[model samples]
Target: MINTLRANLANGIQTSSTRKFRSATRLLTFAAIAAFGLASTSSASAACNGGSTLKGRFGVLVSGGTKAGAGKYVDGTMTFDGACGVNGFVSVGENGTVNNFISVTGSYNTNADNTISLSLALPNGTETYDIGFSPIFGEAIGVETDGTAYATIDLKPQTAKVVSSAPVTTYNNATLKGTWAAACTAGSPGQVDLNYITIDGSTSNYGTFGNVTGVDHIYQAQFGIQPIAGQYAVLSDGTFGGSLTVAGAYPFGFTGSISSNGNELQYNVIYGTGVIEACIAKRVS
Candidate 1:
């Protein structure tokens, strides 16, 4: 179906009657696929299952973040070689100088994004990663080089050996669980409250929801109001609201939109006007 769609999309925008017929033919084909459900792959599902034998550790470059001790940090092995899964350990960097080991594991399935929401355990505690990667291989991942579409892990203790790692399960929305750092913007003092989605069903349509803390007027500390769940789509209402069953221990919510950028699940949530609070909560997933 994806291939058919791609072909139809690139067939050149048509206007002639003959072209229209072809366009209708392609559209009908896509519809037929949708009705019959041509989007199912068991191999992808099993890639990040509980136990499998295809496991391995990898080493990749670290980029992004501007803190003095932020760039070029490697502490744990990007480990995960299993039959029905894919995962890795993000090396320790500025925030990784304390925890002994920090890693994640889970299953993933997507063409544009190689991801799984594995469990992320650290010295401070354990959380899940909106874990993402490009090119699913043993140790040959991290091709984007900007650290944009990878697991957004918290800084942990530095260790030479990879202590742990696993594949994140997308079916469980592992992309919507984690600790996010948001500031107490200028005006929205109380505590910036936000909620959002992190999992990218694709590079396009997916959802992340949130609310933010109001700004602090006196101390000037950008404290935030975290949702018990990592994100929300309810918009303060209870309808489409998404909740993180694992964020109650924190204090700030998030500020991003559940979006799909015409490709796959990508969090396009930004700091919009009244649409969002002062400080924004974006899904780094």
Candidate 2:
């Protein structure tokens, strides 16, 4: 089963549109196994105090490239025990029903440098991940220990707690207004393009999109400007919701929901050609 899953992940990586989704699905498959197979009651070591920083539920987005140049993204949720254990679910496809769905359980160690080492035990094998946390607390970036894959994840605390500082004001035109450093990926068959932009989200949000090629390298700026227009609403429940349109050479329809803490935004977007992309963006004001 592990070999089959690996084969599927490798095959999915070759295609641009579904690479991350496929990889996430496989991860979730192991999650499901762990949830049912592993024991839930485990004590944390004295060195694991950093787990407290990860308590609560978080929305996760993972994107990485394979040694062969295939790019993949994974979307899911992870819940930490504030001790050392973690349980989560991941999926691929529209509404998480398309290709695969999975639940995972694991142990983690928080390093002194704000990085984490995670180990997930699956029916087939154990996978290790090295994760780096953002200064914002819950947001993090990660990569496989073998360097075969890399990913970025944004986590939103599901429970109310004192953030590093007082919570930012509610999501409004004023609070949302800023120049944000944005990274995005547009995936299609045989080609996956990464985009980096400086987004000004004031009255009418607009920015320049740079076509980034080569693994983890940002080259010169490419042609064309991307424009976005949208309105955001702070729901009664404290979640942030909004919709926007990308009026550019390759247009996209985007909808997003942000955590109450105002640190991370989870987005689901569809291209004019009907290709779907999902990502998490952090506020860098």
Candidate 3:
């Protein structure tokens, strides 16, 4: 986090301040697994151009890849040949249907469903595989075992709107135009007041400034020139920062967040000395 930013307004009295934030991109991906002798297509919500990929039949197809248990050709199907896996086995076809294997097999779509009906095919029935029944085990006796392997395939229509990990509700152009009392502070051990009135915004906002002369009359009971004034941006995380000006001189400003309720607006005022560092407020409504 940048913490805060400030720039002198050429003049001596006023200054501009900005709150800090971190802007970074985040993406997430995970894998799904299913044991032998099963169909492709997950039972979860995944978006794909219909079912276009095939799953298992663990083994060496008469003609697929040099890799073990890999599929071959575009036979509108592929099978799993149980090879080196936890519960290895095989599923054959574009629909990923197969029989024969071992333990552990479940599912998740290599591609799920679509809001529309979509498929990939040539103009003619120029694509289709013939059925074959050629099984080989040994000279006579037979022994078999199934295996397992996990795979993570990309869902079709890879574009997705990241759902916020948290819920965020919105409010209309509602106005907070009432007079109320509040108690506030500026630093670590700041003081609280007996009463103070709210000016603008609402229970959760930087609101508007204008208490007599815009100075936050935080203590309600104290009487003097206000220390800060200006527009503030309240963040969803309940923090705030912005600029403020005094009289007609160079605009002095602060950056901070709100606490307790709308009644308080604490900030870091950077002026001559290092800074006021922190401040606090409360609603006297």
Candidate 4:
């Protein structure tokens, strides 16, 4: 009986040791997997190369106030050198009128934390912005940093990278042959205008000049929906312009650039009311 009891005690000790060994092995395996996941996340976040990541042409939109006045809006295309220099043309609206396309020059720097700083020399003065990049979306988003003005800016790649297909190098009238939904904002400090428009650009009645008809719904005015008629023309380089009459009376002009994928358009309106208006349209059909 004594021998049997001793044997039983020895077996119990061996079993407990085996169980502890298995538990330790599982803990090590879990720790290794967690470390691998953390390493992957760190590597992905490290891919941002700062301002040098911005290259080629980017469609730009700027809307807000300047040090002198309110309601300044700008939209155009900017070409970045992937180093420090940038130049572009923009249509600026201010003081009850919209200026013709004007040239703008700017310089940018990369911060230690991977953020970007930009200084744009405009016709009025130098405007500064704190810019941030999103690798997943491939865009640069920023806001005005100067105390006097309140504005926000965004830039989208004019040329899409080649992945499964060749990138769209140029665009013409037929490239915009579809329906589009547009979200737009226009305003000064006290007065703001917001509109949602559904544009039908699929009609081919006017040859290269596409007949566009849409409904403009002004949310602020509470004017449910008004029918608008317009015509648009796309340039070889994807710059588009058109005039639309709202409710058959009020007329406004607009211009913008199409994305390299031909899936989106970024545009601004010429309201000539001392307010800047910016709109982005995406294809729906």
Candidate 5:
């Protein structure tokens, strides 16, 4: 009878040991899965960099005016050192005077709202802007914050290497060779104009620089849709200038910038009269 009791106790102990072993195995498996999930999350966060991903060179466009009747338009290139420091060169048109290639220095930081704040020291004075970046990290839209000027800014990623000398990169006349869809806004106080344009950038067109041929469909209360043909040029630095003219319509000159990846462009119009104009173009094909 003692032998029989001993055997039963041994069997019970073995069963208990088996259950403990299974419980430990399950806990270890759970721990390993949690660890893997944590590691994956950390890697993704590092890649996104918390939306402070402003690095390398970017093409910039600013269009607007101050309250005091001085209109401002700018096309430039800004290079971020990836450490909050930045250098810029811009062709600025203010009032009736146009200055080509002016140098500016600045610093930038990202805000909680996913906006970047820039404090730039121009030759005239200091200016500040708040820029909201796109999810693709390739483009952004910004506004001036000083209350003195009403400005809208556009930023596009460029593949330029340096800003000190002429950039030797793939961003050239050929970079803009594609079909793009453009949306533009321009007007004075009571007369606003909205333009939807289709731009064809091809080498077969006629121009010293690369050719930009487009059809501008004007949407206004007076005219429903005017399919107007326009032509422009793409410079070595990816900026462009030309005119769009039609019978009984206003002939206006335009200046623009092409992104390094050849996917986007921004343009602004210049007229003798006081007007606000800007265009953003995205490649469709």
Candidate 6:
């Protein structure tokens, strides 16, 4: 059952790009509002059951090194309303020069497998990105549909002091704190097997989750290019959660879910230059 789900998850990542054009069109409505400075009144809150996990304020970083001729990077903050609306500003950098802040807007689709599809409107064009959340839900990692750019997003509950005040209801951390074996696969290719243990109510034990074994370096690197090792903080509201960088070589974030019984944890880990790795961690003790 686990393998089947993992395979399906992998397939979803591969096919997510097919909807790029369609996604762009759907986001135009929000883009127009953002361009006109009407974002303050834009509402994405809807009374829907199974509340969305994408609601909150996110710090985003986009990086593409000469993939399209000139290296590009974007730093900005984006806000999502848990339904499908998003708005933000991006500081675009090209060839090591900071350009100007550009307003952006878009819509997103939350997939059944915990992946997210986003269509963001930039001044130049609309671009699509596929993001994956980690088991706890604090961070997201994504890449442009054309693979020309990549991004890492750090999210925090809009109401930090009162998580319950957020639009969505999340799981309790006491029910999900533990150690488990983890297996991860990237959208591109290859798989990684490792172990992860979460504790302190909101932090993870940092370790590697990539090609440490005698796996093929090329294939392993495709999915597990960097060592999947870092300390991650579980979001206050649960819902697979998010993370913050306390002290580390790279920033980390993730979102996902723990099975009702708390034995299974499924999530995506986002880190270093926009890489999203789907991970399943099963409690063994």
The prediction achieving the highest lDDT against the true structure is 4
Q: Which ten residues in a row have the lowest lDDT in candidate 1?
A: 259-268
Please state every model's RMSD to the true fold in angstroms: 17.5, 12.4, 25.9, 27.6, 28.0, 16.9
lDDT of 4 by residue, 1-285 (tens): 334434655577444323323322332233233223221211112233354666667778877766676566778777766666677666777545666456667777778888788788777678788888765556788998967577788887766563344457876667877778777766544443334444444435334346567777655555557787765666655566666666665446667777777777788766535355777787887
Q: Write down the lDDT that model 6 would get.
A: 0.46
lDDT of each candidate versus the true structure? 0.29, 0.46, 0.25, 0.63, 0.58, 0.46
How well does candidate 4 match the true structure, expressed as C-alpha RMSD? 27.6
Q: Of models 1 and 3, which has the larger lDDT?
A: 1
Which ranges in model 6 have alpha carbons more than 4 Å from their true place? 1-51, 95-98, 135-137, 150-285
> Considering TM-score, which of the candidate structures 3 and 4 is the better prediction for this target?
4
Colliding residue pairs in candidate 2: 20-72, 20-73, 28-102, 31-103, 31-104, 32-103
Candidate 1 local Cα displacement, residue 236, angstroms: 54
Ranking by TM-score: 4, 5, 2, 6, 3, 1
lDDT of 2 by residue, 47-89 (tens): 6657866665555555544345444444545566879787755
Write model 3 residue lDDT over 104-217, tens digit each, in one string: 322212212212221212221122221111122100111111112111111111011113222122211122233433332222123332223334554332222222124444
Model 6, residue 284: distance off in Å is 33
Model 5 misplacement above 4 A: 1-53, 69-72, 93-101, 110-115, 122-124, 134-136, 160-169, 190-200, 203-207, 218-227, 246-251, 274-276
Model 4, C-alpha of 64: deviation from truth (Å)? 3.2
Q: Candidate 4 regions off by >4 Å?
A: 1-51, 65-69, 162-166, 188-208
Per-model TM-score versus the true fold: 0.23, 0.48, 0.27, 0.73, 0.62, 0.39
- For TM-score, the strongest prediction is 4
Off by over 4 Å in 3: 1-198, 202-213, 216-223, 226-228, 259-265
What's the lDDT of the predicted structure labeled candidate 5? 0.58
Which wins on TM-score, candidate 3 or candidate 6? 6
Per-residue CA lDDT of model 6 for 54-85, tens digit only, reads: 66655455544435444444544566767778
